[model samples]
Target: MQEYSSQAAYDRGEAVCVIGAGAAGLIAVKNLRENGFEVDCYERDTVLGGLWNPENQHSPLYPHTHLVTSRSQTEIPDFPMPDDWPDYPSAAQMLDYLKRYAAHFGLAEHIWYGSEISHIEPVEGSRFEIVVKPAAGSAARRLRYGAVIIATGHHWVPNLPSYPGQDGFRGTILHSSQLKDGSRLRGKTVLVVGGGNSGIDIACEAAVNAAECVHSVRRGYWYLPKYLGGEPADYALARLQRRPRWLRGFLTDRLLKGHRELSARMGMEAPDHKHTDEEPIRNGRYLEHVGDGSIQHRGEVTRFDGGEVAFTDGTTVRPDVVVLATGYKPKIGCCPPGLLGVDGDSPYPKLLARMFSPRVETLAVAGLVEPGVGALPIFHWQTHAIAHWLHIRKGDPERAANFRQQVVSESAQYAVDSTGVSPRHHLAVDAEEYLAGLGRIIDTLEQEPAK
Candidate 1:
């Protein structure tokens, strides 16, 4: 690879380069092609589907991983999943859906599997120079493109927490991503850490599979059941958005009152912030398991001693396996941090309207937001707007300038910092507000240019 470093980059004028062949990347390719731009999508792994595919070495999927967001809400707007599929599809089904999407849109030809964009930087103005590093031991190739969209998602890197004495603890410790099979918990006393969806789900799995299950939650979180009002919970709640604002709150409260009371009865603390502020835990069986004494819910983890874990509530548990379902950190390793408007030491990027870069006009990120809803539709609209914006920028500078202003104003209006400071809430955005912003941007991009 070093031998090829001195060679000039092969310039593909006007072609868009999409990093990662996951759902977001595939959508970007399809949208770019539809908007009459040539596209080249690169996937570091041999397979597509990103984290959805279990074969991907960095996949964060655990045993029985299913969609927290329901089918109607989760499906891509233009490419719906099968009608007969379950409301909440499994991880395997998601991979199958992504494969079908790529095939149906003829996106595979534009994809370079086993190739990664090792580095990318602005070359001439907004054009980008990218180093295409092959997974094989082949010489790395350099290419230049008109623009780049980074779809390499944030779930690959696990956010493991450190506790006192963790290094010498006698039990085995595993991040949620590493606990790929339920059999690992069988007959063992399992301690699941974190309060996110993954933690709750894995704890439920442990409740059924392990001899004992102790769940350590650091803070309170909204816990919604999988179903409400005889329909999928997310879909039902989303439908309420169409109702009058005055009626919406009342209806939402009525729907959630039972679950809220149930959580309180189980000795769980009420969430400090609104449910929309963060991704809520949506597991139906977790509370039931706790009620039945199959799962013991404990406070935050304090420390680790020889074969024992201490909690904030002064309780201690000796578990054979400790699973840390602490979620993932948002990281874009290929591109320079400053290019994504990363200031100081924060790993998360400060984007324009949560998609476009605040610094570079031609660099954008997709699927980097936690919208507390189905992210697939958000990815679809984001790529759609990005593709249209790129097309407009190439042909009409006046419209592009106006569009950029709209993005800046919208970004300012929905600035996420006002929501919270927790790293878990860093990428959080209200789904309704964000989708409306995306719709406005798309509408502006699609409008006729000055005659």
Candidate 2:
């Protein structure tokens, strides 16, 4: 095969380019197509399910990984998951659902598998020039598109923490992604680090499989069971949003009171922030395991000594294996940070309304927010707004200008308070607030033009 010069890009006129064939990307493609735009979706992996597919090298799934958000809340609004499936579907089931979605909407043909977008730069007339690097031993291809939506997601890069003497510690250390099998934890004294959802889930896994399980955390987080009052917890909680504000709070507190007391009884520090401020840990079996002494909870790790780990509480644990479920860093390496409104040295993108780029009009990001609910429906509405925005920009200049102001005003309503939260929670948004914002944006787009 001959290599072509990187001089000219193959022009794809007015065709939208979607990066990543993940659930978000697929939804964007479908929504854009529904809005009458030609779309080309690119997936770096050979598979289309992104992190949901275990075959994807970057997948963070471990054994027995299930949806923290229940099925009714997690499914895409237009494309629901199977009715017979469990309320909390497994990772494999999620992959299957995504595949069915792509097939149902005829989105697979539009996706270019094994094609990774290496770089993107805005060219003349708000169009984008993309460098596509094939996974195979083929020459890089240059292409141009009318617009770009990045759906690459934020879970690829592991946020590993370093402790004193970590390099010299004489024990096996693995990130949650690397611990793909439960057999690795069986019969070993496991130490799970971090306090996020993955850490809690892995601790529960170790509680049942490992000889002993110890969990370490730096800060307290609100923990909620999967169900409340005999219904899915999120659904039950979300239903209160329709009630009066005063009544809603009273009802919410009543639902959460027991769980809060249980954490206190287990010697766990109460969360400093409100439950709505950050993503809460939703696990039914973790507290039970702790109660039974199958899982021991400890404070943050202070240092790593030879074959031993010391905690901030002056306790030391000698574990045969350490698992770092420290969560992931949001990364979009294909585009410039400045273009995404990233100021100074912060890695997080400061997008307008948490989706569109603050600086670039034609560049947008999808599925970047931690909505603390089923993210699939959020992506559906987000892409719906984005597609309509793009369509308005193309055909109705007057309405588009007004809609831009509306979006700016809508974004101000969601000014989040990230105080006391980790940098990883920088992208976190109140799901209720975000959905309300998305609804307003969608209504603006779908409503009839002024008479």
Candidate 3:
């Protein structure tokens, strides 16, 4: 449990500090470390594998969790899934895979677990100070890094919405981020609100274990299969031989649009969420819940009285525990209250195209976005691009302007998806977008870094 000796010299090159030892951070660190940068990874959790590890601190997120995304596409590059393993590896297995990745690539020595980075501020000029709080007896420490990558993937903070009785409720209420397993909810009636993947998973878990389960959604969503012909749906879509790229986009949109049209006809809610509606994530398993009947759909939580949760349809239901499978708020520390120009009223952390803080420079956030492809790949792509631009190639004035413009253009092009939908992009759409982004990063690195 020893620490690396602190250096006094500023010319010791850059310490590329990455936050969140999750999938994205691990990938970023592995690549940056291999690229010969002095990399330090920070994770608040004792164990690695942010989403893969199951802990009570996280409840229902643990048990019965099989990855919906295929093992092949989900794994890190150069690391293939074992043939003997199931198509969709369980959370425990994914954790094992991550452990293997760390060992195989010798990333364990570079990572500092249970260490939470509190802030990344411009100390004086281009240099940045990364302040972190060690998990235990160690006092706070600071490292001066020339560049920092906020690969602290988006899902850590729970995006829960406040409801009427949330405060005075006698029952326990928490978000999916707080969900670890179904142990505590044993025999207790649980109410899961939201229609995302987490909401569906929690409802299924509750149905199997809880006394009674109810799920409410403000609108309906389109559900797609995780795989087609034994390959991931996303992978299959990419390899579609019969269609051209334009046709694929057209056909993809048509298929999604068709599902929405059909859902509306069947007395079920359609793809139209609120106009200001939080767009449904690109996912599998929405209609499956209705078919399974695990979740009794209440319209929406109109209000609540002590033990009863009233719905928008004027019906009332009382439950022992109310779990807001609602989304997570971005975990930005004590910073100024500001908003984005794109979405003026929203907070500052909501970046455009996952970069361009619009105010902060030498500080770039890479993983707050959601792409159709998956956070696994998109986050790495973002970190790869942001880290390269900020650390490895910071010197060129013209290139920096171009980088900023590209980010702005990318944000505008994807603005509909970002501003209209949730911050994350659908995985199917994101795969290609991020791959292109990564390619651009590779191209940009040829110039000299800002000294």
Candidate 4:
């Protein structure tokens, strides 16, 4: 790795440094600024939309990508997306929405595009010294700030899987991010791997575009249409969450009965966990493709030989191209592992309340969890709490001390404690439970300190 010399660290006293200009980072800056903090946001990409912008070289958007969650549920709380837009909007529209948000809040002036925070070090007084590396090979600059909020998000690092003889396989294999053009699948026998939203969506795409489409799944997954019960699926489900616990399950099952029966008839594995455990597959077209025999559902890929790909069930297919939609690994590369409570060799941060750093009071990570719903709203609330807490901490030491304990207790309240879950599921949170916790934390911060 090449090393660059960093200039003398310039101190921006009492200011906050926010990494990444993604939706989360933008929200963090807006909230911090609203709380009267001097916030400087850094974006590695030239644009401010983060992964939503296809122009971003590292964007994970595949062809025809759209919001898996509905517009109402996905929009930021304070700044809702256009009311005239469809229930689910396209990736381009999402980028536009984010850009609009930045413009509306005047967040662009606080953002430094083409600047990445290569590293963040804890200096004296609980402040952070951040190295800003420019994309154009300029010398790195160092700056100090009173606090830092990491909102880089976790979608950039592709979690690619290796198969036996994959190195020598003759077929072209690409991660979903690399499959930028749908024309690449045209007239080719395609295999779509993994069972996440990406995988399912790509399979449906290939079902329509490819000569033959084979979808490889490792286990059972819930296939949810974009809509259910005459409303956007996520919105409907979220509404169900407000009902009594006993009735919620019965109502949910009824709503999802058609999907479950269809998946079973198609020989799909039943998901081992509840529907809410992870973000379910949200494309309505995937199963329709399967029913029409446009998508051949197969077990996990066992090996690749010459041009033949073998599944665990011993079936083989010679695909011209393979798309691996196996999602991303949660990685915070800019900060030291210890600062985020990452155990040895683990990339995921063990955050308090899924935002605050367990080890550093002045540091927090936003939009790191998979809330199984619209993520922007969650980011809004998380950053809202963080900004409010920072404000309280600056004024009332007694209240700050009490609020820290409240956050720790709040974290435990909604934890999805279970064994044998995947690392991806580690970030999963029940959105309803988490939002309530965030609300409580905000309420605590807003309450006046005892006289």
Q: Distance from true position, residue 244, model 2, in Å? A: 1.4
- Give the clash count for each candidate: 0, 0, 26, 0
Off by over 4 Å in 3: 1-12, 55-60, 228-231, 240-242, 249-266, 273-289, 334-345, 348-353, 356-361, 390-408, 417-431, 444-451
Q: How accurate is candidate 3 locally (lDDT)?
A: 0.63
Model 4, 39-82: lDDT tens digits are 99999999888889999999999999999999999999888888
> Which of candidates 3 and 4 is the stronger one according to TM-score?
4
lDDT of 1 by residue, 181-289 (tens): 9999999999999899999999999999999999998777788999999999988888898899999999999999999999999989888887777788999999999
Q: Which candidate order results from sorting by TM-score in descending order?
A: 1, 2, 4, 3
Shift of residue 347 alpha carbon in model 2, Å? 0.6
Candidate 1 TM-score to native:
0.98
Runs in model 2 deviating more than 4 A are 1-4
- Residue pairs with backbone overlap in model 2: none
TM-score of 3: 0.81
lDDT of 3 by residue, 334-421 (tens): 2233422234545435565655466556566655654444355565566666656654445565777766766666654443342234
Each model's TM-score?
0.98, 0.98, 0.81, 0.97
Distance (Å) between predicted and true CA of 171, model 4? 1.1
- lDDT, each prediction: 0.91, 0.91, 0.63, 0.91
Better of 2 and 3 by lDDT: 2
Could you tell me the lDDT of residue 329 within candidate 4? 92
Local lDDT at 225 for model 1: 95
**Once superposed on the true structure, which residue ranges of model 4 sit more than 4 Å away at CA?**
1-7, 417-423
The candidate with the higher TM-score, 2 or 3, is 2
